[model samples]
Target: MPSMTVRNVPDEVHRAIRVRAAQHGRSVEAEMRHILESAVRPEGRIKLGSLLAEIGRKIRLTDEEIAIFKSVRDTTPARAACFE
Candidate 1:
C-alpha cells in the first residue's frame, strides 16, 4: 500500500472538499480516495451499461418484436459506394 501527502492545498479548495465529504457522509480522506480512483480508472469511471439499460427500458421491446426485427435485418443490399 502506498500513501500520499498533499502539501499546501489552498484553503478554499480544502474547505470545499471537506464540505463535500461531509455532505456525502465521508471523511475527507475517503472522499479523496474515491476521487483519485475515478480519475485513474477510465473503465470503472463510466457507466455505459446503466445508460444502455435505461435506453432499453424506454424502448419497451418484447421478445416477439425483437424476433421480428432480427428477421428483417440486413435484407437490403448495401448502396454502391459513390466515388467521384
Candidate 2:
C-alpha cells in the first residue's frame, strides 16, 4: 500500500468530511478515498447525434426532422465509431 499525505486543508473542510463520513458510517480516511476514486475515474463521452436522436424520438420528432439534424450536425463517423 502507498502512503499519502494531504496538507493545507481548511478546518471547515475537515469538519464537513467528518460529518459526511459519519453519515455514511465511514471513517474520514475511507470517505476521502471514495471521493478521490469518484473524482479521478475516467468517463466515456456521450454521442451528440445519438443523444439528440433519442431526445427527438422521445419528443416525437418526424423522421424528416431527425434526418435533417443527423445530416447537419453529424460528427465525423470515424471519431464517433471510437465511442462504440
Candidate 3:
C-alpha cells in the first residue's frame, strides 16, 4: 500500500481530527484515510453500471434483443494506443 505525508496541519485541526478519530474508535491515520475516501467518492454518486441497468429496464429490452447484443459484442481485451 502507498503512504502519504501531510505537512503543516494547524494544531486546532489536528486536535479536532484526534477527537473525531477517538469518537469513531479509529486511529488518526485511519480516520484521515476514511475522510479522504468519503470526500472523493461519495455514497450518492451515480455509477455507470447502475445507470446502464436502469436504462435497459426503462426501455424494456426483450430476450432476443439482449441475445443479439451478446452475440455481436467484442469480448477481446483492448490494446493500448501507441503514441510513439
- For lDDT, the strongest prediction is 3
Q: Lowest summed-lDDT stretch of 10 residues in model 2?
A: 75-84
Model 1 misplaced regions, further than 4 Å: 44-84
Off by over 4 Å in 2: 44-84
To one decimal, what is the Cα RMSD in angstroms of model 2 from the true structure? Answer: 9.3
Per-candidate TM-score against the hidden true structure? 0.50, 0.50, 0.56
Clashes of each: 0, 0, 0
Q: Write down the lDDT that model 1 would get.
A: 0.88
lDDT of 2 at 11: 98
| lDDT score, candidate 1, position 71 | 95
Q: Which lDDT tens digits does candidate 3 get at residues 23-48?
A: 99999999999999999997789999
What's model 2's overall lDDT? 0.88
Ranking by lDDT: 3, 1, 2
Best by TM-score: 3
Q: Write the per-residue lDDT of candidate 2 for residues 1-84, one digit (tens) a residue.
A: 886999999999999999999999999999999999889877775889799778877999887987797789857666445654
